[model samples]
Target: MSKSVNRVQKALEDLKLDATIQHMPESTRTAEDAATACKCSVGQIVKSMIFEGAETGKLKLLLVSGKHTVDLEQAAEVFGEPLIRADPKRVRSETGFAIGGVAPLGHLSATDTWMDTALLDHDLVWAAAGAPNAVFSLPPQELKDATASRIFQIG
Candidate 1:
């Protein structure tokens, strides 16, 4: 396994989660692709997005459902400041994963995390496992707990 994928696997183990990372021949980089590869509804895919607080330059993680997009204005209110897209380089450096495979857990640096309430509607959701083609499935509540994410309507 690649180091990126291994890191995510170790994270799952640390959480005492039995979720298994699956390496698909096809890319699971995009939410649509992941849902297709996992044979699930598009809404069941977790999109791990990173944003920067414009004022503080602090990174924030958002675990949103595939079917919705984050509203920057609302997010700014939730974050207590304006938000900007985090640079890809900074995201990788801080989270230890690239844009297409940023997982909800196992970050190199801790960031404030929030999960979209939409994800809780699903029993199982798939998240990228630190590689474009790697992913794992777990209960939505387990994911919320593992990441210590504050649940909110992110989109």
Candidate 2:
């Protein structure tokens, strides 16, 4: 396994989560692709979006459902600052994963995390496992707990 995928697997084990990481031959980089690969509804795919606080440069992680796009204005309000897309280099440096495979947990640094309430609509959801072709499934609530994410309707 690649170091990126191993980090995610170790994170799952550290969290005591029973989820298993799967490496698909096809890319699971996009929400649509992940849903198709996992054979699930689009809504069941978790999109891990990273945004930077414009002022503080702090990173925020948003776990949004595949079916929805985050409202930046509302997200900024909830985040208490204007947000900007984090540079891919900064994202990888801080989170230890690239854009297409940023996982909800096991970041190189702690990040403020929030989850879309829409994700809770599904009993289980698939999230990227630190590689473009790697993913794992777990209960949405377990995900919320594992990431210590604040629940919100940001998406």
Candidate 3:
């Protein structure tokens, strides 16, 4: 395995998750790509998105369903204001990975991760694993624990 894949595998292993990181034969940067490769509903693909908090205005990761968009009004009710899409520089500084390749876990810091409650509806979900061409399968709860995320109505 490549060092990048190894790091992601190590992190998932450390969490004791029953998941294996697999390199996609094609680009797996988008949730649609992952869904196509995994042959699952786009809704079953968990997209870990980076956003800037409007309050502290810091960058954070939000794991949402591929089938929907983050309801900003609802997010604001909890977070105090609309969130902004995080830029590339801040994404790398915070998550230690580029935007298109960011994983749901293994960030430089926790950065207030929020897992979309919509994900809990699926028995399994796919997440990017350190690189755009890599992915992994796991139950939603494992991702929540791995990322230290709180469950929220993100969609």
Candidate 4:
């Protein structure tokens, strides 16, 4: 297994989650790609976005349904600061993953995470597992609980 895959597996094991990580021969780097690979709807893929808090300069994570987009204005209202997209270097330093495969959990640094309420509509959701070709499936609620993510209504 690659280092990225191992990190994801270790994170799952540490969390006591039984979900298995699957490696795709093709890249599952984007929502469309992952959804197609998993044979699921676009909305069932979790897009983990990382941002930097403009005020605090801290890393923040947003887990949203693949079919949805996060409203930065609404997020600013909730966080009391504008969110800036983290650079690839910053993303990897904090999350242990690159732009195309940032997972919702197992960060190298502590990160504040929020989840889109829309994801709860799905029974099963797929998310990146620390690499472009690695993915994992879990119940939406279980994923939320595992990450201790607060619920937010994303656009």
lDDT of 3 by residue, 1-155 (tens): 65556777888888888898887789987778889988899988888889898787877688888887876667678666778877899888767888888888777776888888889899898988888898998888778877888888843
Ranking by TM-score: 1, 2, 4, 3
* Model 2 weakest lDDT span, ten residues long: 70-79
Candidate 4 per-residue lDDT, tens place, 59-95, comes to: 8899989999877777788777899888899898778
User: Tens digits of per-residue lDDT for model 2 on 7-70?
Assistant: 9999999999999999999999889999999999999999999999888989999999999887
Predictions: Cα RMSD each? 1.0, 1.0, 1.7, 1.1
Can you tell me which runs of candidate 1 are displaced by over 4 Å? none
- Where is model 4 more than 4 Å wrong at Cα? none
Residue 112 error, candidate 3, Å: 0.5
Candidate 3 residues lying further than 4 Å off, grouped into runs, are 1-4
| TM-score of each model, paired residue for residue | 0.96, 0.96, 0.90, 0.95
Overall lDDT per candidate, in order of appearance: 0.92, 0.92, 0.82, 0.89
- lDDT of candidate 1 at residue 50, scale 0 to 100: 97
lDDT of model 3 at residue 71?
69
